[model samples]
Every structure is written in structure tokens, then in C-alpha cells.
Target: MTTSIAQPSQTKQPQHVDPAKKRPKVLIAGGGLGGLSLGMLLQQTDIPYEIFERATEPKALGSAIALSAATDALFKQCNIYDEFVSLGKKTLSLQVIANEQRRVDYKMDFSAQQQVLGAIGHVIARPALHDLLFRQIPKNRMHMGKKILSTDDQGDNGITVTFSDGTTASGDILIGADGAYSAVRQNLFKRLKAHNKLPAADDVPLPYSTVCLVGQTRPLDPAVFPHLLQDDCQFINTLGENKPWAQGTVCWSIIRFVEESKTSTDDKNGHSIVDQEWGPEAAEAMCNEVRHFPVVSGNEVNPLTLGDLIDYTPKDLISKVKLEEIVFETWFGGRTVLMGDARPLNPAGGVGCQNAMHDAIILANWINALPSDPTSKDIENAFRSYQDERLPWIQTASNSTRFYRTMASGGIVAGLLRFCAKHMPAWAKRKMLVVLGGNRPQCSFLPLVEDKGSVPPAFQPSLLATKPKTPATSV
Candidate 1:
């Protein structure tokens, strides 16, 4: 409850050692948000680490992401909160509409919630967030186009990671921050199975009943899209009538402000737009689905349709993908461990990315807490502690996301929740917000640079964020 971070020990300065001789080198798989964030944290702590990514280039190839109050706290600790706030658009309220009638059915105002929690939720393009994290990491430490083929635990010496390009690297520990289809996780499970130590139901794919299509629209004209400019409400969700589970459609659209200045196409950081590829068939199919669906707003005379939004979006940015859930039973073995999507979790609650960031912080904390020249057993123990501290919260967040995804998927429970959410009294809604928004974990090593204000005692430091210098070149 409101636990303040313990300052670094004044008497014992962290011993600097030759990285090649004494320091334990951390090998990170994947270069997504979690991996990159972890690299930044390790840099801040002077922890030796290397990041390997299969992708040939650093490209943020997704739509928008919602950063909650908890995530906002992490950003502030990392000294990038101001950058994020400036680049992203804050969402004040959520409006749910009936697809058939083209009218607003429910609205969840977040103004009160923001005031209570002291952190406002913002919606920003995925690429923008990626660029922010990527810039913080040094060029030499990040290795792109290196696909990991397998990993071998070399007992006390270290772990050997073999890449697809016939190269090998040894590190004290291996972390799987790769996304859903993680090669590191696959290898870990395989090794466990070989040793007959695999847990029950450990590597099953997450069940997904919903298919989502997401894209960002080009800068909107305030004259043509006045409702989109309103800070009062930034996001809108449209749900079909209740149907059998996983059989109905739910569409979510947000007008993201990719840039603050209309005249400037280039971001304030001077990065030009990176092109992405979404096949023609996929784009056509997504546009076909919502071509006629009304884009309803509060009492607007005429609203745009899904097709109009897609038309405004760059063809390359649109994407269609199924949403799935997975929670791994085992997170670590020997010198290798899992984090972010590799751990058991789903992407529904809009908290997946935030949780991924949390994983980096917690794991880094445990790792950084070890001695400068830690033994193999010491590293293993730190990993065990990392899983112990994080597994329960990860499970809770996964369940919450599952519940929300089910409710949004159009079913009996979905109808019930919608009814309750629509008719719930203001006080009841506030109470619900308090319950959902409480107990968020902040970074432990970083001091709270900007307090949003007093939050509930439930808000405490369970994770830590870090800063990095120099940009890394692609391998």
C-alpha cells in the first residue's frame, strides 16, 4: 500500500567489473516492447545484455494501444512520460453504441476515474510507442535479423543460444520476451518435456472467439470530423445484438492524433512514417465487413461508416487478426526464462503491453538485486523470485481480460453486463472504477518524478522502469 521505493544503498556503490570476465551477460530474445524496455532497464543498471530480433528492421506494425494509469506511472519513471503525453491523445470517456439502431446505448465516463486515479489513459499509435522505446536502446546491443533456433543450458558455465544464421552466443541467462509464438518458449517446453519435468497443460494455444481488424485513420479535418476532436470522448465501440458465444461482431474505432501539428507530416522527433504491408485481400475483406455500419456519435446529423474510416487509413496500416489467450504454466527453467506474451496472458484488456512492460521491470529488479558477480545458483534464484512475485498478478490481469473479451463478444453475459453498465448509477460506476484501478504496480528503483496526485494505498511499487542512452544500429 503506497510503498515508496527504497533508495540505493549509500554505503555500497555497485562494483564495476569487466563484463567479459565477471559480469553475467543477459541474452534477450525478441525486440518488441517488453524486450526493448528490459534492455533499457539493464542499460540503466549497467547490466550486460544483448537483444536479438528476427525481424530485419525495426518497424512498429500495429495500430493504437491504450496506456492505463499504471502504465503511465512506468513511463513517468523512465523520464519519457512527457514525450508520450505529447505524442498521444488522452481518452476521456468510452461510448458503446448499438450497431443496428446507430445510437448510443452506454457511456463510461473516465473523467472521474482519471481524477481518482491521478493518471489519464491515452491512445497512441503502436509505431509511436515502439519508436520511443527503440530510440532509448544503444545500437550495438540490439541485433536484428538473428532468428533464435534453439537454446542449451551449459550447467554452471552459462547457456548457449544458437541462431538460425549459424552463429552462437553464450550468456548467464536467456529471457524469452518474444511474442505469442515464441521460439524461446518452444525450446524451453521441449527441453522440459525431454527431462519429463513439463507441467500439465503447459503449452496449449489460447482460445479466441473474436477476430479484430485495426487501423489508424489519417489526420482528420476538424470541420469534417468535429466529434473526433472532442477531448470529452476519444474512443467508440459498437456491438451487435446478443448472439451465441463467439458468433457476433464487435467493432472498436479510435481517432488517434498521430501528430500534434497538422502541417507537419513528420513526427516531432523527425522520424518519417514507416511503411507496413497488409495484403490487398485482407484489406478488402476488412473494409467489406464494416462498409455499411454506421459510425455513431452523440447526436451527430450524419456519421461516417467503417468503410470511410478504412478509406482514410493508409492501405498498408490496416490489419486483420484473431485475438487469442494463453497462460503458460511454467515460466523458467535452468538459465532461461519467459516474460511478456511468452508468459500466460491475453491481449484483450488493452493491458497486455502494459503487463509486458511490468514483466521487464520486475525481472530486471530481481536480476539487478543480485551481486555484481553472481553465481549460477544466484541467477536461478533471482528468476524464481521474479516468477513468484509476478505470476499471481499476471493471472489476475489475464482473467480480467478474458472476462472483458467475453462480455464484448456478444453473448448472454455480454448483454447482462451491457445492461448493468448502461443502467448503473454514477456512484456504482465510480466504485467499480476504484476496484479495477487499484493495486497497480509502479517501478521500484525509480523515484516518482511527477505524482499524478494521491492514489489509493493499493497503488504501490511492484516494478521498476529504466533509462538508456545511444541508439543501436541494426545487425
Candidate 2:
């Protein structure tokens, strides 16, 4: 099914009101996935909000994003789960291939688990998902190229934000969906440190020893990579042990058919395609590193090399980055809060995007629960509640990613894990898969976003409770 991106229709702006008389206005910085998802939720709830992106226009710049059941639940709450599923390939199994011979060390089949858990993972191109979210947002509410310079909490008046262009916008609450190096976080911490409230280690970068290169090949021919095209497979990972030549576990995540091919006039979605070209320098460097890396298919007589995958990939789509892990100790202060990569996590498990979307859903739910004319204290309580509910899960996710990275890196523990995964009884493996797939945080609000209750407790704000009917006031 081809999903068409509808052009945003222009609508008259709401009349400007005095800052003192306006209801709580949400000022979201960084219009990436988290910000846009939050904006969509706010729009659904009829809450006043705006999203700001530093870029001139929406450009899907990253590689593929894997959506877990937790994230799928958020999509369902927004009534877009089916549309979202239609845009990506269902990921049913994961194969961990090892060494130059392309031997399969461990495999996880998710088909049966999907049946048991009621949700299966999907791997989609980042741009397609971004475009899907972008189309639903109101044009006037999404401000492009507006880089947020700094934010000020104006006590009873709310928060004031200044952008790179010297203009100013004020809102009752501010959200720092702005990624890792967030200006909102920086400013908030500066003030907190001045007041002796900031933690000493909160400002440093998380340590990282792994480098990752991600890219997509054109529509893959089954004959070339049959394993990737199989009904029960979506991604293949080649894991290597530590060597003198390469430090840590060197791993490659090879994803296929993440997005459908684009036509000259439109994307799989009927919207006009925005051309994003990749340069050769990065691709050349990546190809040099993994030229001899091997990948195997059950049907093929011989294994394929990483160089072969690169050869088929368009040069412009390749991206390289160092994999780092950082989970902030604090997520909010006063009326300003952080979401998504701004909160930080290890990328090993490919759950960063899912977690970010989860943050948006939970935060939006809390904000929507606030009174019609919430006080600064009311907003602060909501921020605290949002952080308190999400921090433990975020930390768990970070630790899981770090642990996976360690297991992928050849070590005594990695060997043990691989052996267990390979030799475990079928019943035990299915039980483990059921546990892994079943235990995920879910959204708890309207439309009864139901999934397997085997997961952890999600923040379920009292939907039936009415907001306080206080006089309209600023932050």
C-alpha cells in the first residue's frame, strides 16, 4: 500500500492573547521524531503547542529505525499503527553471523513470539517514518530553520525562548526534544549548577569505544542475498571478536527492503520525493573497513562480503558515527524537560527511536492531564512525574544496549551467551523470546491502547479525572 503525504493546508492562526491570560503553551525545541510525535499527540488532544526544527526543511538523514511493540502501541494510540505498519518490512528473525567463514552463531525467530506477544518489530527507513509524521503536523505549528539559542523560565510568566534569528517566543512550558548536545538542557543545568542543584557528572560525555557505519542498498535481489529476503528474516548482523587491528566487538547491521523504491515523481507515499545525495568520502572509508567482512545465506553456495553490500548501496545514503551511551541523571527542571536523544542511551539495541517515541507519548499524556490553567508548580509536578516514570526504564534500556554491545564483542561472556543461544532447547528459546517480546512498556490511555500485559507498568494517568478549573495563568 502506497501512503501519500498530504500537503499541509493553511489555516487561520488563533488570535494572540496576553501572556498573562493564555493557557499553558508547550514550546518544543528540535522538531525530530520525538518533538513531532509529541506535537501529534498534543494536536490529537487539542492542546496548544508548537514544534521548532533547526533545519530548513524535513530531511530523513539517518538509516533504518526498528520499532518494537512498545512503540507500535504509541502508533496505535495515535490511530496510525496500521499506516505505520504498511510503510515498513516486518522483522521476524535475527541472525548473528560470525567470523570470515560466515558461520551463524546465534539466531532468534520472532514469528511464534509475535503471535504470543501480539506485536512484531518492523524496520523502516528513517525518512519514510519522518515524512509520515511530518505530513500530519499543521504547517503553521511546525517552525523550520528556527534554531533555539536559549531558554528562560520567567517564574510566574512562563518560559521565554530566543532563537538564532533574534526573535522570541514564550510558552507556559518548554520541552528540550533537541537531541544530545541540547541547548535547553545546557541552560537549565547552568542555572541549576549556579544554585548548587546540578550533579557534577551530568555534563560529561558518555564513553564510547565502537564506531558504526550504516547505509541502505537499492531493492535487494533475492538471488544475491536470499537470507535477507526470507519470510522469517529482516536483518543480519556479522559479529567479530576483539583483535589487535580492531578494538572492541566489530559488528555490522545489514537491513534489507527497509523502504520501497521511489518513483521519479513520488515516494512510496504519493508526496514528491526530496533528493538527498550522499558523498563518496564516507562510503569509501566505510568500504575500506569492512571490505573483507563476510555474510552468509542458507541457500547460497558461497558467502558475500561487506564490499558487495557497499557496492550496491548508493553513495549518498551512507552514514558513519561513533556509538556512545549516556543517560542523563535529570530529565527536567522547573518547566523545561528533555526527551529522546536529548536524554541519551546506548544505540546497540536499536531502541533509541522507540524509546524517544515512548517518552513523547508519556510526556504528552502527563501534560494533557494538567489543569486548564496550570500553575508553575503544577507544571513542575508533571515534569517530575514524567521523569520519575521514565528514568528507570530508560536506564534499563541503556544498560541492555551496553550489555548487548559487550556480548557482541568477543569475550568469555560473549562466548557463553552465543553458546547458550545456539544450543538452548527449543522450548527454552521460545520462552526467552516470549519474555523478551512480552515485557515492554505500553501507553495507558484513551482508545485503550492494549498489548500483552506481560510488560512493565507504564504511566497510566487518570484519564477520567478532570483538570482543575483555575483561572488562566502563565508559568
Candidate 3:
């Protein structure tokens, strides 16, 4: 049965607040999920924004994505909640198994998510979600093949960004919504270092301990993979004795955790360090290594191998990426600011993209608060507020990602942690679930979705600060 959600006009026309006041023209670097989501949110406002993507064409990279209650309201406010549900498969439970031993470790039940949080999360393919966000944005606003080479905050004159083709675009503000190796972030940090204002932590290279090979197969035949027939998504995660991998409903990932020293140089997959170039050659190398590995979750009688699934997936959809977890101390300097994977989380947790889109929501709310012809201080203040509101949550998320990494990476510590998690009390588990699902931020300027969950949403300072002011009644 399909999930029923309130239907709002997905293509709601832009609502301008004040025609006399000129809003800021935003230059957004990167046309990934976060940037696209931000552009979609900005579309509902008077803000004029343009998205720059380095890729000449879109690549259907990565694997599955779980959309949780944290951004349920934001989707609803954007009026794309129904379509998101249609494209996604609701996940009820997660089964963790010991791969070599062929024993079920524990199952994480998420049935309470709907009752307590009002929205049980769904697992959708990354490309599907990316396309969904892309649909909400106008084609003209999104510029492909324009790589952001550098940016300059022109003080009172606003900001200007130079492209790889030597073309330039000037705007009131520049937002780095680029991925982990963001060019906008690189330029901003360079400027900060020149002025001796860059933080010690921000100056260092992004560190990672794990690399992942992820992909989603073309729609499978239900007779061959019976789990595909199930109404809810089947998430079967396995902790290998040595290396770890996980298989979702359709998407799968082979995660190999490396020593810190090994992370900086190279991996067995032949993919270069840091510069995670995703192409057929690199992905084929990793696929060959894990192809022989048995897929315990698919088909009992026939027993499919990882090779079968790899063959099932299109070559273009596969991607290999280093799972980097870090929250930079410096978020903004001058009129240039950063968001999304500019500060990424370990993909092991699957919350990185969610947090990126959430960052867009919060940042959009703050940006929407800026006045026409605002001063440099005004722009800085808005960016500061966005960071202050998101930093604590990101720190919490980073710690959570590390814990997930420890659990999935496998070792004495992981075993103990997995054991503890397996036997964790129900009430404690519920509390943790609440913590994970609680923050449901919406666009402050849009009509609010009614809160129906028993658990109230976490306090959003951006929403409260930018809420519409009530007019005073004349005596």
C-alpha cells in the first residue's frame, strides 16, 4: 500500500514580500543535493540565486538515502512530500548480521517512528532524490559546467566568483554548497589564511578512515529477488569479520575501514587518496575485489553473489568515495559562507545528505531574514547566526557518525558496542530514536505544517528568530 501524505501544490509560485526592496542575488557553488535544495527553498522567496556545477552533465552517483522526520516538515512546506513518498520505500526495521558467522546479531525496529515522530522514514535511491530536488528548481537558475575557481567578497560592493572559463558572476553573497572537496571552501580558506584568520583545524586536510563503493541496481525482477516484492524496505547490514559491507533494498555499499595512516595515501581499490574520482575504471577495480563476496540477504535457494548485483547495476551509477567526518570551526568569513558537505559526515551513518539539506533549510531561513541593501556586518551576522544554530547539532551528528563507524568497522571495540546496542533497553532506544528524529525544521516564511507527533520538534532558533511579527493593534 502506498503511504498517504497531505498533498500541496508542488509547483507553488514564488511569493515576493516587498517589490520596492531589492533582495540579495546569491551565487551558489555546486549543484548537488544541498545546493539544489537551497535553490528550491529560495525559489519560494524573493531571493535570486544561481547554482554552478562543475560536471558537464549529471552523474547518477552513490546509492540509497533514508529520508527521516528531521526534514519531513521542510518537504511538506516545499509541497513535494507526496512525490517524495511515492519515490521512496518506507523502512520498518534494520537487521544486523555477522557475515562470516551467518548469525543475526540484532534487529533495530523503527515502527515507533510514525507513532512518536509522525513520519516513518523511507529509503530512496540517491539519484531519485537528487532528481526530485532538481525538479523543484528552474533550469535557468542551474548552470552546469561552470566550476567555481575563486571568489572575492567585495566588501560593500558584495561578492564575485570567477569560473574556470574565466567568466565571472557577481552577487550580494556567495554560498559554498559544494561537496567535501569544495572549490568555494578552498578559496574562502585561502583568503582566511592570507589574513591569518583561518582556524588551525580548518587549515588541515579533511581526514577519513573509511572508503566506500556504493551503487543501486536497475529495478530487479521480484521473482529473482523476493525481498523487492515487500511493501517496506528491507535493510540487511552485515559486519564482516575483517572488512564490512551492507545491502539495502536495492542499493548496496562495500565499506572498508582503513588505518589513519593508510587513508592519506592509497587504498587497495586503486582509487587515489582524497581526490575520489568516480569512473568505470576505479569502480570496476573495487567491484572485482568484492564480487566474489556472498550476498547473504538475497535469495535463499539460488543465493546471489555481490557479482550478480554488480552486474545488475548500470556502470554509470556506481561511485567510490572516502567517508570523511569533520565539522570545521570556521563556517564563514566575510560575505562568503559554507554549507552541506563543505563539512561532511561519515556516510556509514547515512545522515550526511540529510544534514546537508537540513543545513540548507536553516541557512535559507537565516538568509531570508536579511534586509534589502544590507551592510557587510548584516551579511556576516546572518551567516554567524546560521552557524551558531547548526554547529551544536552538527557536532552531535559527527559524534553519532563516529559511533556508527565504530560499530560497523569491526574490532574488539565494535563487537562490544554492537553487543551493547543489541541488548540496549527499549526505553533508552526510544529516547535515542527521538533524539535522532526530533528536529523537524521548516521554512520560516512559508505556511507551517501542523505538528502531530507526540514528541515535539527540537527548538529551532532560526525559525523563532525569523517568524513573522504580529502587528500591534491600534488602541
Candidate 4:
């Protein structure tokens, strides 16, 4: 399940010329995980691409961690996994510790699978990783202070982009590694929605009830969160008023584990886990409700024509998102198409980043089959092969991410479901496999052909083959 990029051994295919190779002048928008990742891939390759980040500078921000197999290897492929690992605290398991009177009722574990996936959830400040990636790619290639105004698809060629500065430029490919709510995807979706290329609103809204708070905290001193130091697993500490309290009452990010991977305790001065915390004050607030405090309703009636689930997530959670999905219905106009989330934004399963990384690796392998030079059709077919082979994995991971988060947040209902699971047959127990994100392909992002609906190529596993003796030891 860990990420493995097999050196491909495919039958010989027609050669394609790298007309856009060494002259790679890609304009990547939004310097987030996807953008930074693609830029880093390009940086490592013979291609050249520049990142146009909307932020004036790479600012330190966003909450914490995510688990991915393909992404870790992508970092390994790009040669940055070790550096990231050293900076991140690896989670070996996803434990569900059902709590009763503050005592452990039961525990469900997930780690061996994470290891096989080559990544457990990784914890690093968003800014920290961004700065690291920003530093990895030369400063000259990454531009700050520029915002995208508009993007237009040019006929049979490329994309024309207009910047906020009133300047325009054309590129062979405009990779909109933009995060969900992407401006690029938005315009494209506008066109598509107008043309009815979108799924019906009812089928898309797909809602579930969840009203929860999600945030991080100041680095907990070892004494503050003793259990966290003893293990490397992320936890859902559930305490029920009934057999199903669903812990948070509504679904939200819960932290039963806390450990900071800062170089020195003194270095922890800058990182803030979240802007708020739920403690005595919160408990008191809950005990005393403010009448008409203002109840807010949400929009889940229609999922966007573009992006992923994110556009539907509450705005309050947007800033907290460390990594967003890749959404591009089109990249490279038509000549050299792009796949993966980079196309229509990869879904947010634990493997989004991994999936994106897998895309690059698969593309590299797919291209290797072609002769040193390739014709336009050859490149087009290569793109098709890449899509046919990789899309299913991307889809599977995306669906898993959505499913896992849903169950994780499943309030009393989800908890009751898990509790009832004990009485069910062994086959029913396997249902939990999806919540653990154990049922998907090992690689996060393999290539794909939408029409063909393909599977991924071979891949290897990660160092997390077994749960670390404890989280501290692993970090």
C-alpha cells in the first residue's frame, strides 16, 4: 500500500517530440500543496514552470496534518520526503477510542494500512511545508503578489491568462493547480453549467447533518497531553451521554493526541495549532445557551460544477484546510492534456496529495514508452493511456476521503452504527475498512483515462509497515 513507482516495462509506443519540454513555461496558479507539488515536479524535471501565488509572500498559516501514500513517494520522487518527515510528526494509526465516563470503552486501530500506503497522516504547519517547498524551488521561479483575473481557453492550442495587473500572457499550458473554489475552474464551470455539463443539483448536494468545530491548539507540553506522546495515532475520543454521543455531538476534527515536532521547544514560539480551544469556557457556554444567539444554516443544496467537496464545506473551515483539491476540467488546452486533481481537483481523501504525486510518476512512466520524440497524436494517446490507467484510483481515494470524514463526523448516528457493528457478522466489520481508508489503491494518485475508467500501475509501500512503537519514537 505504500507508494512505489515501478520502473515501467511497457511495449514500445510511437515517439513524441518535447516541443514544450525544455521550454516549459508553465504558469501555475495558487501556490498551495498542488501548485507547489507540480512546480516541484517540474523543477526536478527538465521542464520549467513558475508559481504565481496570490499571497504577498508564503505566510505561515493553516491547521495540521493529512495521510497520503502516493504524496510521500512523490516527495521521495522529488526527493523531499525525508526533509518533510523530519519536519512532520507521523501518525501510525487512526484510533477510535470510545469513551465512557472519561475511561476507554473500546479502541479500533489503523496504522499498518497507513504504512502500506507509505504515509500515515503527516503533521506540519501549512506555512512550514509551503516555505519548505517554496525554498526548494528557486525563488526566481516562484512569484508572489500576483492574482489571477481570468483564464480563457484558446482554440486547439493553449490558454490565455489575464492577471490583476492588466497584463496578459499565453502559455502552452496553464496548470490551474488552484485550490478548490478555483477561479480558473469557476470560469470553466460557468461555461459548463451554462452548457449543462454539470450533474443535477440534487444528485450533487448529497448532504448529511454536521455542525462542529475544527481547530488546532498551542503545542501541548508533554504533560498536557500525556496519551499523545505514548502513541502515533490520531484519535477520536468519544464520550457518550447515550451509547452514541458522537463525541463532539456534531462531526468535527477531534484531537485526543497532541505532539509538536518542532526542532526545539523554544522554536515552538511561532506555531499556533488553532485560533481557539474548547475547554472550561466552552463547556460553560454549552451549559448556558444564549437564546437567539443566531443559528446559521448552510448550503448543501448544490455542489459546485467544479472543484471538489470543498466549495460546499462551511466557510469557517476554509482557512483551516491545509491542502485543497486540484480542480481543472482542462489543462494544456488540448495538445498536451493534464489529468489527476490537477484536472478537476483531486478529491480529499487521505490520499489527495499522494494521488497528485502518482499522476506525475505515472505520466513520466507513460511518456517513457514513447520514442525520444512523439507526434501530437502519440502524445494525445499517451495522455489517454495515462487517464485510463489513473482515474479510478483518484476517484476511489476521493470517495474514501469523503466517506471517512463523513463517518468520522457521523454524530450519535455514526457512533451507534459503530457500536452496533460489534453484533454484526464479520463481513459487516469489514465495512469499517473504508473509514480507515484501507480499501483503496495503495498509490494516492495513479494516472487515468476517464472514458476507459482504469486502474493504477504497480507501487511500493512506506516505512510505516508496522505501527511505530510509539509516536514520539517515529517523529
By TM-score, who's the top model here? 3
Off by over 4 Å in 3: 1-10, 101-103, 261-279, 472-475
- Candidate order by lDDT, decreasing, is 3, 1, 2, 4
- Least accurate stretch of 10 residues (summed lDDT) in model 1? 243-252
lDDT of 4 by residue, 73-132 (tens): 455545456767765556554434444334344444434434343345565544456656
> Cα deviation in Å at residue 227, candidate 2?
4.2
> How many steric clashes between backbone atoms does each model show?
10, 2, 0, 35
Instruction: Say which candidate scores most in lDDT.
Output: 3
- Using all chains and alpha carbons, the TM-scores for the candidates as numbered come to 0.82, 0.81, 0.94, 0.60
Query: Which lDDT value does model 2 have at 98?
Result: 66
TM-score of candidate 4 versus the correct structure, residues matched by position: 0.60
User: Which candidate do you rate higher for lDDT, 3 or 4?
Assistant: 3
56 Cα displacement, candidate 3 (Å) = 1.4
How many residue pairs in model 1 have overlapping backbones?
10
**Over all chains combined, what TM-score does candidate 2 have?**
0.81
**Candidates arranged by TM-score, highest first:** 3, 1, 2, 4
The positional error of residue 250 in candidate 2, measured at the CA in angstroms, is 20
